[model samples]
Target: MIIVIDGLNKHLFGDVLDEVFKLRARVFEGRLGWEVNVVNGRERDQFDDLDPAHVVSIDDEGEVVSCMRLLQTTGPHMLADVFSSILDGEPPLRSTQIWEATRFCVDTSRLGQGRAKNSISYVTSEVMIGSFEYAQKAGVLDAVAVIDPVMNRVLKRSGNAPCDYLGTAKPMGKVTAMAALMDCSDERIASIREFAGIQHDVFLSEADALRLMAQRQEAKSPMPKPSVANQDHKPLSTLERYFVEQMRDARTESEVQDVLRLIESLSDTFTPEQKDALLNTPRAFAQEA
Candidate 1:
């Protein structure tokens, strides 16, 4: 399953974003030893604040196994901002039709080596398929990604060879970074899908995605009890209570995810404790039911 987190639906995916960051930390900092900003087990940079779209892949168990970031080239992005050095003094490519893709990674510990279910090859292709499909639908014509030689080979093997290269490969830390351009077109997507043996739509409905996300989150660690979640705990707002009640009244898993997304989206305006209470309401309902 795949879920896209953009500015519009980002609020519904705070937990998914959290896992994405951790996965980046594990791959970029831990394995690749790349020069990245990892704080408290999350890899992040200024580009994250620019509201880029994130294409994420989860397993049947609802665990976020892979993810990639997308930002319009017209705005502040990785290649234009932090990684402008890759241009080798040339100007960064900026256009509404072109988007930058970066921070592509998969959970190696959870996935195996072969191109099977829960395999690195499987999720990698799924992420590539999801990224191109997503960019194309968003009116984007191309995608620029900062990758190393290893990833370059993977792209070639998967039939997603870069159409062009922006600049020379430069050493970042222990590894080298090079900017590669790929087209977001039907032909390109079809080739990658065919290579990966993918024959179905690579998307999970927003409701189903949220539902899947909750399953993984609950499995990892239950939310802290509200009393100890924050010292200055505040009561839920009236509207917040309405959302929580709606979550309790939800009948199906789809409806549960929908109402939970609604409650979470509205939670940022309230206190931390209030948000916790809103999200934790579902568990409380399960207890009562």
Candidate 2:
């Protein structure tokens, strides 16, 4: 399933965004050899600080399989600020109806081949469908994507090829990059869905999303088991240990705030009765001698 994370709800999905960035670091920096900023295993750029909308495809286990970053063309975007060489002196396209899509990637190492929902082909199409649907609903008529030749071929194979090209391809680290434009319309989305054999809604419920995210975190770094000889040592529960680790790993004030917000959202995962029961549970108490 896919999850749309934008400025409005970003505060609620910090962990999701973190996972997206980590995946980007692996693909862009580690795999593609791009000269991108990677801090603590997260590939982030100035555009990320601009609060761009992220359309991410998540697996049943809550792992981010594919993702694309969307930014309005009316503001500072890649073609305008970073990849000006591609434009070759022509003015950058700026309009409210046009948006810029960048950082498109998929977890090729994890997703296998075939037309199944969890396969790379299916997840790629699902991400594209989510992006187009999201852009169209947000009043965007066109999307300009900064992608490589390989990605261009993938787009063409998926039946969502770009309607036009913006500029010549230029060397970008290990691969050449170019700009291509695609119309964000129902026809394009339908074509991708048809190609991928996706016949139902792709969005996951909020509760399911949260649970998946928690599971993803656990899968990424499981807690170590306590040793038998350490019976005298106090051990934290899994939840408490995870919370402490998150705080310890935080590098900035914003990250600390994100950790707090994620903790706050955990309250919504349970009902009032469950919350009451958890709070009213009996615990051992020491009596004064």
- TM-score of every candidate: 0.78, 0.78
In model 1, pairs of residues that clash are none
TM-score of 2: 0.78
Cα deviation of 240, candidate 2, in Å: 13
Instruction: Give candidate 1 misplaced runs (Cα > 4 Å).
Output: 217-289
Question: Relative to the true structure, how large is the alpha-carbon lDDT of every model?
Answer: 0.80, 0.79
Report the C-alpha lDDT of model 2 over 1-289, residue by residue, as the tens digit.
9899988767557888998999999998999889999999999999998999999998877778899999998889999999989988899999999999999999998899998877999999998888888888889999998889999999999989999999799997788989999999888898898899897988876556655665566677755443322233345344434444555555676866675666556766545543332223211100100
- Model 2 segments beyond 4 Å from truth? 215-271, 275-289
The C-alpha RMSD in Å for every predicted model, in order, reads 8.4, 6.3
lDDT of 2: 0.79
- The residue-by-residue lDDT of candidate 1 on 241-269, one tens digit each, is 34444554667887778767676665555
- The alpha-carbon lDDT assigned to residue 103 of candidate 2 equals 94
